[model samples]
Target: MEQLFSHGISDSISDSIPQQLYRPEQVRHMEAEAAARAGVDMWTLMQRAGAAGWTCLEQHASAEDQIAVLCGPGNNGGDGYIVAALAKEAGWQVRLFASAEPKTTDAQRALQQWLDADGEVEPLLDWPESEPDWIVDALLGTGIDSDLRGDIRECVEGVNEAKLSVLALDIPTGLHGDTGCALGDAIIADHTVTFVAVKRGLCTGAATAYRGKLWFADLGIQREFRLLTEPAAWHLQQDQLGQWLSPRPAHSHKGQHGHVLIVGGSQGMAGAVRLAGTAALRAGAGKVTVICEPGQEFLVGQQAELMVLGLEPEDPRVAELIEQATVFAMGPGLGRQDWGQRWWNWYLQGLERSDPQLELPTVLDADALNWLAESALELSSRNHWVLTPHPGEASRLLDCDGSDIEANRWLAAQTLQEQFGGVVVLKGAGSLICGSEGTAVSPFGCAAMASAGMGDVLTGMISALMGQAGALNITTEDSVRAAVMAHGLAGEAAAQALRPGTSRGLLASDLFPWIVHWINPNDS
Candidate 1:
């Protein structure tokens, strides 16, 4: 086997895994699953991993160029040894640097294979005459703890300083595959050729920055691995939305799509609810009503699709609208003052009318969450609601610092769900959706969504989905998840509209057409 592979990376590789994302422990366990299956073993998987990395390198680097291979003590490092030997055979200048001796038996066997191929492993103390054109980071993979220290820390720093293009084998060394958080300092790769399933962390937050262009190669265990375990979190894709969407027949009417009552857009903040209402229309809401302060009705009137109704806080129509509403999208422009405060109190106070079976699926956003946080209530009753809050709002709701909320977004989402019943969409770089079903993290989105009215747009989108899904008797979490996926894709499309270098000026309205594309499968 060693003699046959000494010629360099061959085209004999496995299928690609683009959809499924896994936690570190999950992927490791799946490796065992793959090894346990017939005609494959741990060493075979490791060799395939090495070949995968080598193929990625050949695609990115010149054949005549020098390559710096950083190897560790674990099987991750063993993969490095094989990659080094393969690169050398492929006729590149392969300079192998070893931080430690091979630890596990499989790693030991892989090390011997490199020696048989006459490849030498050098210590970092010795410097090569010329800098390598590419660096292969095979050190310290997913198994490492949060504390990135000792020789590994120094090695990571060296790689980052070299600032050269790097191809990280499964994940960039020092990045917690489970959390995608950099445990201290991590390698910044130009591209990461990951094996098996994708580590969930690579799709969001700080971990996302280090992995430049991610490509996946499943190593022939895609089906077996999937059969062995479920994913920790789903990376939302456009395709997933199709199952969640119920097609409307030619006989379908506007009343059947479900009505959406968006309650907010207080005085001086009318555009907030307008954006939400527009988003609901784009998301296939049969009818959207924007109920705001008396002077704010004109704000929603600009959009001819939305029906704007202005009312005083104590108006009888408030309860009437709530009764007639299919779903309520609350808190887009809701302020904490008298006008916004009164309406919030009305919704909270009025929710008591419905039993759980007939309760409205409400999307609680912006100041509605603030009102909840300020009320000192445990939210013991509102089981049919979705709270969408950014990190700052999440901090307020959870009573923790914003930093704590940002530290572990999934944990924050779970804590919020525990505190406030119903779905909690912890919106940010990687927005998390936590509910009774489980948690789903939004994998696609841009920093562009950080602009002023983005959340308002999402509020409308998800609420419309929830209302529409209610007509079809679909699950609330499913509707919410689909909305999040659609919003993210829309945001990405809006961002792409800008010139290549810049990611600015993407407005909430820019996502309207894209939302239509996501909702309608035929259009997509």
Candidate 2:
């Protein structure tokens, strides 16, 4: 959204990486031509890439450090050769391994340069007896997506067994450059220094395990590269918060912020609606009302701020409150029983009868998404809602297996938004938000977020932000992004405080204070 670093960028992209994310093919097709337009050739760009890789290697190594470099047969291998030669010149003990002899002219020249520098290459099968301080993976950069095979697969296996900290250049070998899925096997790197541009693969899906602590080096062609192509998606940034939220006017009242109506908290699952309601309050909703089963009021309304009305589907008060609500957050603990089903139908009928131009802003999550999938009701013309679904829910909505959704999350998110009008938040490791404004990925969440009730909290946060969109002076898409970012930041903060380096015991409610902290971007 707001590109604070957009202005006054330094010559090197490393100083300020652009938020734009590109598919690997975009970089591959445009990079050479873009470099030429910028008055640089492909070989020179390779050298700069090698130098950048050398710099990253230096961060994890020192002179005399034993570093093993794995080179491929193409340009990726050429970059590896250049890095090995520079390491040798810097007095580092370099052990270079190649799956095959350099094939391309540029790679052939690079190999000769390394030979002239007196560096020897070993066969791929020669596993080093001695462990090195760091292993440099320069093999298979954005080249393959089918599956790993032959010596390359064996090499990937060997490197993984070594378990040394790895610095992967461009991308981890075997990771699909576009889908982020492993071809067959992928190198697990501790740090990956991607060159030219940030590949969409590096930020989400299975790549999360193989590509760790990502670093980007634009290789001086980013300006030209960006001019050559448009980004397919955006990597979420904290600075984007400033673009979505601001301080409230000093004389503002609670009613001015907007009201959020939270539906569904069946018998034993009243906690879901409670969590959603409380999260709405914590996230700055002016007022929150939880509509649950007739007897769950005490459990749902225990939080003083939440006005809980435990009523049946036919209760007239339900219609009255629904009419007054500025936004609706449906699902959460809404069960699949007759009671929950009746409420679902009630809401659907209201939406069906409402004017298309003035449809209330809504958030569909948890059991609500499940019910929506079951109903198969098409609301493709309404664009005032948000659907937040996990892989399972998305799979249900798309009529596919959950693994298919995870295999290519970008496609899943896009398809969901296309099939179901309005924003779609595909929640997981690299949560993706797709809408009319294009897709954005929030890479800020933690594994601790794997627990239950997290999605409910996110539903509440989204609803709160949506209700406040008018006052915040941002679009519905901006509101969704802001809520997702804040939710992720809160989870990260809570996980760090509770378990430091591991994600073990963080709870859904633990994020309340942090949600308040992040929701108010100006204060933080």
Candidate 3:
């Protein structure tokens, strides 16, 4: 199967906020309110909604195809009746399977309309007797509050057994619209055409399997409706990154950018430091210096344009260099040896005593993050820092099992941010960047970036962005937002250039050219 990323969706469409995300109850209320505001009858919205659904069906299926419309007792079933009527009118073979009689006036009227059109209406238990090209699930919508059992369970099982393409209305029946939790046996849809607003459950958790090929259609709601409700979550998109990236000027010089100092690389681990230093430079840092073990200085200088500083594993001069740099990238190859521990402790102490107004933004990764977690150092005091951790590292930092972290990546990222008092980048499939006020999930990037040294490059790239002269002038939130987006975009470009299967071999060093390429794609 072709990866979804290969679909080549441009940044423009991806940048648009998903039409609207609403809780199940909230959507029901919105429908009532929108109906009142439209100065039309309550049935008008349902009619329009069903019409929109039928339009989608027309586009998705052919006129000669046979479709089974499954209806329940509520307004959702009313929509299904309307869909059946439309499909019949379009000269398509359509059958109706009702789980129960219409309970609402609109639904009753729709059922009468279907009868008036001479459509087939039979019990849902008869689904096995009929053969249809597609199954339209309208058995339940956002209003489902109880577990699906009895006939509904058997109906769902029968639908699945048929192995026909299914289209769910609003939401897959028996899945919580607010929590993404499945209620008994939920219908697994191949396509879900949601109306008015998107349900939060559709985007996360186990709901991913049930709500496939998600599509949202707004029933002409005004944009001002958004002002009435607070957004519970946000999606990170590529164009949003433009707000954070610094637009370059023709006269801009390297000195006009900011300086970054990368501190790490214990004995025999020079490649990590080289990767970090080169990444920082590639990410647009004007000046970068690598302060590593004396034995690794030659290797650092050979691979990167960065100025390499030869220092003993526990050198005190490292503090002076750190104080001078606009941003610090720490960890990478920093080992767990006693010398590395001593240097790490001294670095934290330096951060504690550093001039409050002159403190530089620091990014902790790999060993530095592990040391912080082990020492239980009060990280909240170091407000200008970012922590990048994979699942194992995050589990240690949060004192939780790795399974706990994977179970809810968003919650884990938030917990780490609240505990550590810095931007927390939870590196994994669907990487999350959480801060004090908000969280952003990178929809790009793949398992291709799963190789060693990737986190080192990420730390360096973020540090460079934070240290950039333009970034220093922005708000802290803005700086962190830009850095996170840039890092993901660079990773995405690199992964795309080297096909998906070949991504594991991708090194942190490979990200540099791609970072430069993405930051200035037109720069030749």
lDDT agreement with native, every candidate: 0.80, 0.86, 0.74
Model 3 deviation from native, Cα RMSD in Å = 6.3
For all predictions, the C-alpha RMSD in Å is: 2.8, 4.5, 6.3
* Superposed Cα RMSD, model 2: 4.5
Per-residue lDDT tens digits of candidate 3, residues 410-445? Answer: 678878888887788888755667786676655556
How well does candidate 1 score on lDDT at residue 281? 92
Q: Candidates' TM-scores?
A: 0.92, 0.95, 0.79
- Clashing residue pair totals per candidate (backbone < 3 A): 0, 0, 0
Task: Write the number of the candidate with greater TM-score, choosing between 2 and 3.
Answer: 2
Ranking of candidates on lDDT, top first = 2, 1, 3
CA displacement after TM-score superposition, residue 323 of candidate 3 (Å): 1.9
lDDT of 2 by residue, 242-307 (tens): 778898889989998889998889999999999999999999999998899888889987899899
Give me the candidate number with maximum TM-score: 2
lDDT of 1 by residue, 82-117 (tens): 888887776778888888888999889888887877
